[model samples]
Target: FNKYQVTAKPFFATDSCISCGLCEKACPVHNIRVVDKPVWGEFCTSCLACYHVCPQQAVQYGKATRNKHQYFNPHQ
Candidate 1:
């Protein structure tokens, strides 16, 4: 769980991010705060809601997701 928390932390690409605050709004647990970029809080559930909700795909979880595609299920 500790490793998961560390590695699963979401970060934003400065160039790609538009600072829309959508990631903060998408976080169900309210664990994300966006000032200039999204900041991960200790209470994050690692549900990846922020990653999927990003319009620019700027949210990334380490190197694993940096180059991958993002999918947002609008039905949810």
Candidate 2:
């Protein structure tokens, strides 16, 4: 029997987002989108530049992360 695994978690933009579009611009995969609200595309590699570059500290990943400081890093 084979077990299926899901490794990637979708990036969520928090209400603290200032909509500055820095995340979108910094995304190497171009998966981050900024409209009136920020959206994560399927191409997201979980690079975490959005979370790091966000001036408002509004981006996070995973349900386990319920704090303002927890962030996701693809390289790590």
User: Estimated TM-score per prediction?
Assistant: 0.80, 0.68
User: Who wins the lDDT comparison?
Assistant: 1
User: Across residues 1-76, which tens digit of lDDT does each residue of candidate 2 receive?
Assistant: 1122222345677788789998888888887779976787766666577777777777776664455573455685
Candidate 1 colliding pairs: none
Instruction: Name the lDDT of candidate 2.
Output: 0.69
Quote model 2's TM-score: 0.68
Which consecutive 10 residues in model 2 have the weakest lDDT in total?
1-10
Please identify model 1 stretches exceeding 4 Å from their true place: 2-10
lDDT of 1 by residue, 1-76 (tens): 6666643345645568999999999998888888888888788777788888898988887676867888867788
Backbone steric clashes in candidate 2, count: 0
